[model samples]
Target: MSDLRDPAPYDALLLLSFGGPEGPDDVVPFLENVTRGRGIPKERLKEVGQHYFLFGGVSPINDQNRALLEVLRKDFAEHGLDLPVHWGNRNWAPYLTDTLREMTDAGHRRIAVLATSAYASYSGCRQYRENLADALATLEAEGRRLPRVDKLRHYFNHPGFVRPMIDGVLASLADLPEDVRAGAHLAFTTHSIPTSAADASGPAAEHGDGGAYVRQHLDVARTVAEAVAHETGVEHPWELVYQSRSGAPHIPWLEPDICDHLESLHAAGAPAAVMVPIGFVSDHMEVLYDLDTEATAKAAELGLPVRRSATVGADPRFAAAVRDLLLERAASERGIPAERCALGALGPSHDLCPVGCCPARAARPAAAGADSPYA
Candidate 1:
């Protein structure tokens, strides 16, 4: 009998995340780190930093990641999974390179990375891989033995990820007035990338017409809506919407922003609506500022009753799902059969990202994939 809990051949798990500013003084530097190569002017970046400044220049992401780390450690310990988990960020302190060096010094040879982003896109998926590759390169230059790193598949459709949103939608609907409850529409929201990037998401062959990014999001939205319908006995009309778009306005990006969608719903005489942030893993800046502050204000102006649903922040179910994912991948690595879990029509994502998966505008080495130089 195979013990599924054995996380062998994987000495450590890394909680890879897109880090944010911790304080007012850290905001500009953090933004500088994010926009390093973009050649954007410093004043322009300061303009962008205003969003962070509004909340005293603090981003909720780092704190949420901290909470998640605690939850994952607790979950692993309680479930008898001995794998040690470490965290690293892309655009802030405790940077990926420094964390990798620490992990190597600590003698963790085989590492499995769980990125905070849960879908397939260059920024969401491949860029994280690129960061890992960059970190490994630094270690290699320093004459340190680089550990083998592998990223777990996207968990957007995992029951542990989706079930919470479904419950959130239900809770939001129940909170609405009785007259508007049945007429409430569902707005499934995610970060909006450029259309070109969206088209290039996922494997090379799958690129085109929204590709895996939009498709995966639609799948999760459908599953959540169906589950909500089943639980409430009311079929709510839902539409997948986009939010938190950055970059040049001349370039095309995903459309029907949450605020716009709310306006349209109001014009259409929809009684109420629920903003389900299916794209985010936690209630980070995007969710906090974009949805809660901006969109909520828009809904109020339009006299549209709106409720922003909860994210899977520090949820124990998500922690258990991470454990399940690690064990399943470990089992597969050991040439053992394991049941991969997911929801919706997309099924489980591939364990290893294939060549050209979520290709970047400029080609670069990405770790933990078919084309990884480290591999």
Candidate 2:
């Protein structure tokens, strides 16, 4: 592999992410920002916002992102890669537009982005691109030049990403009571999207229409389960589950909610379960509330031992993986031999998304710098 320090004239690395409320006062408004066009009542949002309130109305995502930024900076310096990293959130202060302006003011002409999401669906991918476009538009309106930005491919199947979660699952299993560990079932979980959106995910042809979300989650789960079995000499069964469904009741979303799956597992004579949040990078709102609170309560009702695995927040392996991904992309751009890893037989994602990839029903404009294989 080419050294990460190869002289490529990229200006900076942007850590793009879904922002969360930082305090009790920001909760309702932040939720409002997230659900703006959905027309959900504030009272209803308050009910949902209780999850944030449970932990002093703060989300762990921002701190996690900060830690990742530091790791990237330190690793880049150690590897002789000279670049500044700036962070911008999709729905909060230090917003994307402002971040872009700062980068422009600092004389950055070319940028590479690493979105927090690691999948190929619209929300997970394209929407961030669209958000980038919107942010650029705002910057252009303010008479600032927009830097050309490229996003890295999805790292979902990268060993740096997957291996840490495998370790997390094993650790969680070990923490459970011995009796519980004996009967534990692995539940792999992710966000729930509407069936239509899910079906339309990924590039046209080959992958077929939709279902990318489920397929990706399954791939991660199976890989982790296999690794767990290999490391512990235990053959634990696993199931794919969904959480964080925010769509209307009239709209059908992903099935077998984590709680529901836990109930079914208990009924099937399983003594305990370990939840692997395969879909997320950290224990944000969904993992903290849906899994820790809701799913644990359900398991308590069924007298089943339940433990949740940790997210890959600031794991050194994950940080190293990010470093490798940047190096890999740079090498590929230069026509060098680049090492690519992927889940199952899905292969590598496209470097540039094709027209009409992961089409949205109520189509939003594509974001600037949104084009990538993962998106």
Candidate 3:
């Protein structure tokens, strides 16, 4: 597959995602891995486990990651990008540390990480970096060769990611009752983190705000909603709302939850609604439980029609976008000019995160940052 085009600089591509339990027996342990160091009691763990219990104790994320991994492999093959593709999770089997050990043993020196998250936030960006840091630290303790890993830029406004969401929302609008389509409300949904986390997301600006997370979502929401209106002629009213809030009640998070947003639409005489999971890369447990089950149940009780649009799960365009980003990063490493593609207010985020970006509640080494000692 080699040609005049320069070969990819990285030896491997790692698909980093949040992991989930595979079966009934795996639930508690998986959650323990997720909430490690946070001193939640067994009862609280069981309470949260109920969400998985309702789903037969299986989280769909691993299977979804498998599907995405295959799609990425296929995309790499078709595009003649010969780099090996590997998948690992932060909190389950095929864990990031294990994956890193195997990758280095297989003789891969440099790796490119493509996190499932497409936005900027601690969990979305820094937390993943911290995971990488943890994994790398463990590997170093065992005296393994630490590879240079560069996370790809955020894709919140990437044409490929946003385009599929636009298509999904348009299809959802069309699914509504024809008479109510024009009056339908588009509720763009994403996970809600604590208000403190929200305020500290992205780089800590002197202005003291978390603009990137909210701003990027809103920009993408506007772009998609306007396109959906233009293409479907629905003129749907839309707002960026949040879902999957897990924090304590007193701790504030992004406001106007999806269910609440649905109720507001119903009370305002809106006849139907569409949920665009703009915050997620795929329809994982959050999208399934929150939007499919919980929010749908709420809409049913209100007698309001609702349709949930698909996330950009292994969509060909998104896969292509990954290829484009990889090639661009490879070119940049070689000092070659490569185009950076994005569609909304914020342009492409920096390939290398600067220090002081997305500070955790406390200090820890993070991945893909200026202070990433990995290099």
Q: TM-score of predicted model 2?
A: 0.94
Backbone Cα, N, C clashes tallied per candidate: 0, 7, 0
Model 2: runs farther than 4 Å from truth? 1-4, 206-210, 368-375
How far residue 337's Cα lies from its native spot in candidate 3, in Å, is: 1.1
- Per-residue lDDT, model 1, residue 288, is 93
> By lDDT, highest first, what's the ranking?
1, 3, 2
TM-scores for every predicted model: 0.99, 0.94, 0.97
lDDT of 2 by residue, 255-341 (tens): 888988987887789878998998999878888889898888888999988889988978888888887777777777667777776
lDDT of 3 by residue, 172-229 (tens): 8778888888888889999898777777777766214545788778889999988987
Choose 1 or 2, whichever is better by lDDT: 1
Error of 1 at 312 (Å): 0.7
lDDT of 1 at 332: 93
Candidate number that wins on TM-score, 1 or 3:
1
